[model samples]
Target: MKLFFAFAIIAIALSVVYGAPADPWNEYKTKHGKKFGSTAEDAQRKKLFLAKDALIAKHNSQPKASYQLEHNEFSDMTPAELSQYLGAVKPANKTRSLESMVRLEMETRQLPDSLDYRTDSCLPGVRNQKQCGSCWAFAAITPLEFARCKKHGALRAISEQQLVDCEPYDYGCGGGWYTNAWYYLQYEAGGAAKRSLYPYTATDNTCAFSSSMIGAKISSYGDLPSFDAAYMQSVLQDYGPISVAIAVTDSFFSYASGVYTDVECDDPNAYVNHAVVVVGWGTDNGIDYWIVRNSWGTKWGSAGYILMERGVNKCKIEKYPATILSVV
Candidate 1:
């Protein structure tokens, strides 16, 4: 009896040291619906999971952390595996002239202090890109959907899969730019299909696009002023959601809540790796943040959204802002 009691005490102490339940590995797997092919694979994944859990705990424990980290669907993924979700590639011509692009005529009026297109019922439900590096497609499709809904008074889920399969310039799932996807919609595809017609397969498949399925068409698209947050804000207020690229760091995969501000994101030369939609902006406790929507589904972040630190151009968010002027 004494030996058994000692073992129990030891287990409790180990649990305390680990800062997790007695069988956190099992608990995590069960919670996330994880399955491993073999016991060895399971062990390897458990080690990775524990390490990530520890990092999350360490970051959240910080006294002045602007954001908090939490366990989610990505808790079991390695840094490399998490990176597979980032599909936004930088455009070859980083300094593409905006002269050919349509420009929004700014009105000399006070912009609202805060705005969220999600609440206006113009935006569609948050979607899961699901292991495919299709962030560009989601980012591009969302703003067009928003513009169409704003003008037509009906919300529709445009097909990201259409861009994934049909956009000749992009390498579907390998990585692509939202701008290229936008160009494809404007010219080649003639528009975009509805989600019902060409639902996301999350893979590089044969282009199954049909003209009858085209749900929305863009009249013109344009890039906002580089690093100009004020201009970006005005455009977002007038036009709707804007597609932009940002650097996705290690901490970004585990983001849970609060205004996300990472030191790595502040670097001017940081690689812009993921495309996301800027839905709105607001101030939280004197800290201004852009309300951004991600493509990782409702399970990630705050119901498939994140608040990024605004104005400082954190994560190069204002670098490649693009928006659809009108949808037919």
Candidate 2:
């Protein structure tokens, strides 16, 4: 009887030391099925849990306004671990080319107060860049897909794997630039093949992009004026989605939903680590915001989307908006 009582007490103490009876990562584990392989890994996971709990407590204690954070798979990862998973790096300047001479009629058109490309069937279904640092490829491909659909009346899934394998100038999964990917599609690949023809392996593989499978082509690609919200709106109103690279931080990864203001990672140009697509812009609770779509899958963010603070170049999104003229 005494041994039984002592065992119960020890179990309770262990529960207290480890965590509350309710495991916070239960949902994440169930969805991802990620488990620690060794004792060292287990210890790291515990440390991640503590770190995540601290972040959660800090977020919850603050008054609900601007944005909110949620504990997800990234919560268990350290900043360095997260960065390895984030593969989109700023492209080399020599490789960066944008044709500024061509006139886009959209730039001269009157823009709406708000525009969402998804509403106009310009945006395609959300994609998961699972375990691949190929966000640069995905972000670049999104605009082309939408632009092709806008012009040809048929939405086609362009292959990011084609860029991953075939783009001679850019690194495959390690990291690359949206602009570089765009240039590759325009010049090297001679327009990208459909995903069905060149499915994404999320890893570097041999280039098998066949011209016979090519379903879409890019006539030209250009960059929007830096920090110009009006020009951005006009372009989005006409061109559909645009590719953007943003400097993300510890807090940004923890983001679940809300109009993310510049309160956290205020330095948008600190490091253009992650590439995403800006489909539209609007206001939330009086806060101006840019509608950003991420490649972290539909399970993350607001159904694979986030509302970033607008007009201030939040995360350098306004600084480097790249898009292409597409046709099928």
Candidate 3:
């Protein structure tokens, strides 16, 4: 009995000597205690950031990583720019533990969009390597076809580059408005091709319109009407992902992991440099969010699109469907 007691005592002492209580809350509060923002908006974001460490740590054991995908444009960056360049990297890990493949990490606006989906004219699927800003072209066309799939029942795949190289009024190589591109597709002849026809090259090259026979291409859906948030949601709900944008604040850049909230309503357009897609959304921890898909590649913002502040004007809007639509 004496020998057993001694061994037990030694084990207990060693355990106490090695493992100590860790209070992430105390450290977080202490480090950020004196940190104050310039205004109310700034102060809110500050609070959200301070809580970031704890939130990420809270779920560290069960870190959900089902956000992996191919072709991340933002790659090989320095730690200093991790937050800002989130629109660039694609995470190497892909987790399937979570039932869904995506999650929203920030609050977002839940307003309605006033546009239409044209399945015949929309892009087939998501494309990549538009570092050349040809994204203006790619992003614009996919939704057009999504509209078609919604009302017309046309499931044909449309090529965004086809509009870039062929569509008039809108320059295929340069960035342009999505609405205008649709106009060109309506009255233009040489502005059409299948996804397998033109393909994508991330690089900016002159319009090399061709007549390839890889994928199916359809005619435009005549003059359409403006859209509202409900309409966008209707189309998006029926389709898959829709491309959208939100104003990212300083906290957005500084954020490392976990849920994003209490963002500064300063510019209402902080991280306006990047673009992404709206995938899915649901509520957790009493906060509303929207799932977004980013084109900056992968390894950026939670996995692709970091959650934006939804509800209220935190993300600066109350619209549904949010931004552009994507049928492909």
Best by TM-score: 1
lDDT of 2 at 267: 58
Candidate 1: stretches off by over 4 Å:
1-21, 94-100
lDDT values of the candidates? Answer: 0.87, 0.79, 0.43
Q: Each model's TM-score?
A: 0.91, 0.88, 0.49
Q: Per-residue lDDT of 1-328 in model 1, one digit per residue for the tens?
A: 9999999999999988887646878887888899999998888888888899999999999998889999888888777888879999876774432333775677666878998877778888899998999999999999898899888999888899998899988789988988788777777778899999999999999999999999999888887778888888899888889999999887888899999988887676678899999999999878899999999999899999999999988888887898888777
Clashing pairs in 2: none
Q: Candidate 1: what lDDT?
A: 0.87
> Candidate 3: where are CA atoms >4 Å away?
1-126, 144-157, 168-174, 189-192, 210-235, 238-243, 248-259, 262-275, 313-328
Q: Give lDDT tens digits, candidate 3, residues 1-328.
A: 9999999999889879986566543444465453335577445544554455444445344545312122111222223343333221111231211112122223244534222221224434334533454544544455554555555566555666665555555434444434344445443433345666677665445767655532432233211122233333443555544544344443343333444564454354443333355555545456555555444444445543455444443443232122232222
lDDT of 2: 0.79
For model 3, state the Cα shift of residue 326 in Å: 12
Could you give candidate 2's per-residue lDDT for residues 137-199 as a string of tens digits?
899889888888878887888898998898876678888888887777777777789899899
